[model samples]
Target: MTIRCAVIGLGMGRGHAKAYSEHKDCQLVAVADIDAARRERAAKEWNCATYTTAEELLEKAKADVVSIATPNALHRPLTLAALASGAHVLCEKPIAMTAAEGREMVAAAKTAGRRLMINLSYRFSPQSQVLKNLVDGGALGKVYAGRTVWLRRRGIPGLGGWFTDKKLSGGGPLIDLGVHRLDLALWLMGHPKSTWVMAGAWNHLGSRIGASQGKSYSVEDLAMAMIRFEDGSMLEVEAGWAANIKEGELMETRLLGTEGGLVQKNVGEGYDFQAEVFQERNGTQLDLSPHGPFPECKSAYHHFVEAIRDGKPHTATGEDGVAVQELLDAIYLSAAEGRPVAMGATTTKTGAGTG
Candidate 1:
């Protein structure tokens, strides 16, 4: 049974299209984008039908699987439409602009009886998978604390465009880049429920650059947060699109547990990553690194298709996306209100200050 796939928004959707086209059990049936040039290019490259809008593609493409890679604000509506159209959806991360929207999307998918997966792409890396296995195997027993960061010296993307616009892209790197590391940390730590968050955000450099370019930028360039979880585990998160850091790009997730500590960090300020495990045995410290013969790392699209076809669990689910969205909301609210935000039956600001 071949799964017919369609992709919306050709920017990151191009990767989706490529993955689906390459997968053995999937066929790239259609693609949609606002840009005529992108649609034409995708059509020529992937040999698929093209549409001007997501609505048109959903109406006529007959796709069994759909990938939503549109702007942040469009995720909820597009995902709802796709689920209603009886297609399993693979949506890009942060789920939606807000946690409420993410919940709604998850509910819609359940009602439609379709799979809704998020493209938390970073988890698909081999290094991450290995570390996840080790953590699950008790290499890191009872993880108590972690620090995850993705900092770019000067890497604000599409500075004046939708990426920098809060309405269109949600917040800045916290949602864009930070979500990846945060999710990785949480996944490795067994996804503890967040209890409260204290965060600070700034847009100093982005706003100045946008003003000088006569463009509107309304999102933070740097965001830092400390989160407490129900399991007594704590996480420190730092995401920056532009900073005075030494590296052009720096990404790392370190977890400290009762038995050992593990770190997955980028190599040479690039996408390539290396992971290490540190433990003390026989009164001697040992540093360990995963070698080859690692499990096959599958792309998010491939995992989504496999989940749909084989009833296997997806690497990232809508619920996971919602969890991340809740943290993001709490972080933003905490930053804006100058206090810690508590998550419970309902979210509320706490009297405790960042002090």
Candidate 2:
């Protein structure tokens, strides 16, 4: 059975539609957008029925699955609607503005007995997967620490659009870009129990670019967080749209483990990536980089379709998304409280002990 899918919210929704169309097990049946022009363009480009609202499409086409690419604030409502209408969902990252909202969405999915996949696109990147394999297979040894960063020089999307608006986008780079790296870090840590978070966020960059058309820049353009785990593991995550760096644009994540290390780095301005795992065996250091056909999106997109067919679980499942959201909430709470926000019990605690 072809999984009939609908793409809602034409911005990122178009990309979802394209991926779904190209998937062998899925069929793009309709497209919907609040903007009629975008909806019309999508309909013309993809040669599918288009509607001004998702409600109209679901009512008419009766979609089996939906990709909710609406803005941050609309994710919950749109996602709930899709699930309520007996459609599985592929929602964009952040899932919802807060952990409570994310939980509600999860409950909705359980109640409807449908699948909901949150698109943390970075987790699906080929380079990231290679690193994950090495790490998970004990090639990276005992991971002690890792650093994941996403920094851009002058890249700010939507200009005066919702991207910069705090109310709409939730919380700048932290909620937008930071969530990706944070998810990657948590995943690399083997989903270790997040003990607490200490975070610092700033609006310096966005505010400095003031008087521009960028929606008054109310959110933090930069966010740096330190996450601790119960397993004695730690991670440092940083994300920013603007910073005082001359490296043009830097997007990478490195894991330093006791047995070895794994690093995924971007090549200059290209989205093309490279990954490596380094280890010392018998006093000789070795570096391993896998090779083969690695079309990043093709793998992830098709994986979702195959999971639906084979009744298997996806790496980026709804459960994984909730874990990411909880970590994000802790990070933000830590920043707001100027202290570490605790989530779970730790294996070890730093305290005064009589030796």
Candidate 3:
């Protein structure tokens, strides 16, 4: 079956259009962006119809699948509208500004009998899949604690635009970058219920940039949080848009388990990553980086299409997005109130899908 696909919000959605256009079973029918020049450029590049608004694309494009990558604020409404239009949706991460909004979108997708997959890109990585297989297969023993970090030096995106506006982007790197590693860590740890969060955020860099450049910057440049899960495990997460770190960009996730451990990190301050498993054997510490016996995993976009086509359980569903969002919301709240925030049972449901 040829799946008709449309992409909304050309910033990151441009990649979505490319992915869909490259897929054999999918046809890129249209793309939408409020920016006229960007929309035109995207249309020319993807060779698809262009729209000034997602509503127009949804009404006229008739896509079977839609990728929503606009901004943090547009996720919920755009996802709901796409589902209502009988299109499976691949929404960008953080799901929405709040977990409540994510839950609403999930329910709407359920009611409409459409699939909603959150674009948690890290989980789709080959390294992540290898780590996940080991963790899930008990090679990592009982996972207990983990640490995830994504730091970049002077990498604030769209400095004076929606990304810097808390009202539009929800939070800074915590939501933008940290959420990817957070979701990957949680997925590897078997999706534990986040019980509480203690966090702190600083806007020193953003404030300085705003003052110097006379720009509007209202979000944090760096944010850190420690989350406690119901299973007695904990995850330490940190994300920074602008920091004094030595590396240009550093993304790492380390999970400590009872019998073994795993670490996945970027290679040489770049997007290329490698993961290794740690174990103690014969009074020696053994580090193993599995290269074979496991094939390369498919892309998240391809997985979403396969899930819709085969009726399989999709990874990074709306439920998983909500779980991550709840964690983020708690982290932001805790940072703002200068106290630990306890997550509600309703907000911290286990498993994906209907949770």
| Candidate 3 residue lDDT tens string, 292-350 | 66777888899888777777777788888888988998899999999999989687454
RMSD of 3: 1.6
Better candidate by lDDT, 1 or 3: 1
Give all TM-scores, in the order shown: 0.96, 0.92, 0.96
- Which stretches of candidate 3 lie above 4 Å from their native place? 348-355
Clashes of each: 0, 0, 0
Residue 42, candidate 1: how far off, in angstroms? 0.4
Q: Which digits, one per residue and each the tens of the lDDT, describe model 1 over residues 190-216? A: 888789899999999889888999999
- For candidate 2, the lDDT comes to 0.79
Q: State the TM-score for model 1.
A: 0.96
Stretches of candidate 2 off by over 4 Å are: 212-214, 293-298, 344-355
lDDT of each: 0.90, 0.79, 0.89
